[model samples]
Target: MNYLVCVLLIGVGATAVMDLWAIARKRLFGIPSLDYGLVGRWFAYLARGRFRHDAIATTPPIRGERLIGWTLHYLIGIAFATILLGIWGLTWVRHPTIWPALIVGIGTVAAPFLVMQPGMGAGIAASRTPRPAVARLQSLITHGIFGLGLYAAGWMTSFFYTP
Candidate 1:
C-alpha cells in the first residue's frame, strides 16, 4: 500500500468511527450530534466573502450544504491523518501506537474551541452555548473517541501496509 493510500484509509476509517459514535451517543444519550450543515454553511459563506458568523445556525441555508459539510468532514479527517503520519512517519503507521493517536486526536479539539466554535458563534469552547461545561465535556469525550478511532484505524491500516 502506498503511504498516501494508507493515510487516506486510516483517516476515513477513523472519521467513520467517530461518526458512528455520534450516532450511538445520540440514540443512547439523547445528545444531539454536531450539525454538519452548519459546517457546510460556513464553507458556503467563504465564497461570499464571509468567514465568521455570530450564529451559524441562524445563517441562511446554503445549496448542497449537507454534501459540502460531509465532504469537508472526511477531507479534514484525511488532513489530520496526514499530519499524524507526517509527525510519526511510517514507523508509527506500521506499529500503530496509541499515544500519538490520542495526542493528535485530543489536540484537534483546539480547532473547534478556537476556530470553529468562534466562527459559528458558539463562543470559545462552546462557552456561548446554554450549557457550556456540558458542551466542553462532550467535545472532549468526542475527541477522545476520535483518538481511539485513530488507533483502531492505524492498526487496521498496518495489516495491509506493514513496514
Candidate 2:
C-alpha cells in the first residue's frame, strides 16, 4: 500500500515538474510550445465515462505521441519505485526516503532538455536555439520543480500511505 501511494505521489510530482518546465522554457527561451489545451485533452477523454484517453493530445506529445508520453510519465514513477524494490527488496522500500524520489524527480528533466527538446525541434540542450542560456535556465527551473515535487510527493506518501 505504501509503495503504491509513493508511486502515485511521485507521478503527480513529475507532472508538476513538467508543468513548471513549460513555463521555464517559455520564460527563459523564446521557444514556443503547446497551450493549456493539454489539460482539456487529458481530462476530456476521461469525462466521456470512459477510461480511454485521447488518441491525439491537444498538445501533441514530444515522443511516442500522447499515449506514449502519458504512459511513460506515470510508468516512470511506478517503475522507479519498483526498480528500487527489485534491487533493494521490500526492506529498503519499507523505510521510504526522500532522496530517492528527489533524484528521480529531478533527474528526469534531461528527457525534455536533452532528448525531448531536441526531438521536438528545440535542439540538443538548446544548442540550436537563439537563447541557449534561457533554454538551460528552463531546464534548471523544471528540474528544480521536479525536486520540489519529489519532496512534496514523498511527504504525501508518508502521510497517506506510511505506517
Residue lDDT tens for model 1, 1-163: 7889988998998899999999999999999898898899998998899878989988999999999999998998888888889999888878899999999999988989998898888999998999999999999999888889989999998888955
lDDT of 2 by residue, 1-163 (tens): 6656556655566566566666666798765644434423443434345433323232343433455455555566555545444444434434556676556656666765665555434566767667888768766666666656655655555555544
Model 1 spans > 4 angstroms off: none
Candidate 2, RMSD to the unseen true structure: 8.1
Considering only N, C-alpha and C atoms within 3 Å, which residue pairs clash in candidate 1? none
lDDT for 41 in candidate 2 is 43
TM-score of 2: 0.56
lDDT of 2 at 37: 42
Any runs in candidate 2 off by more than 4 Å, and if so which? 17-98
- Backbone clash total, candidate 1: 0
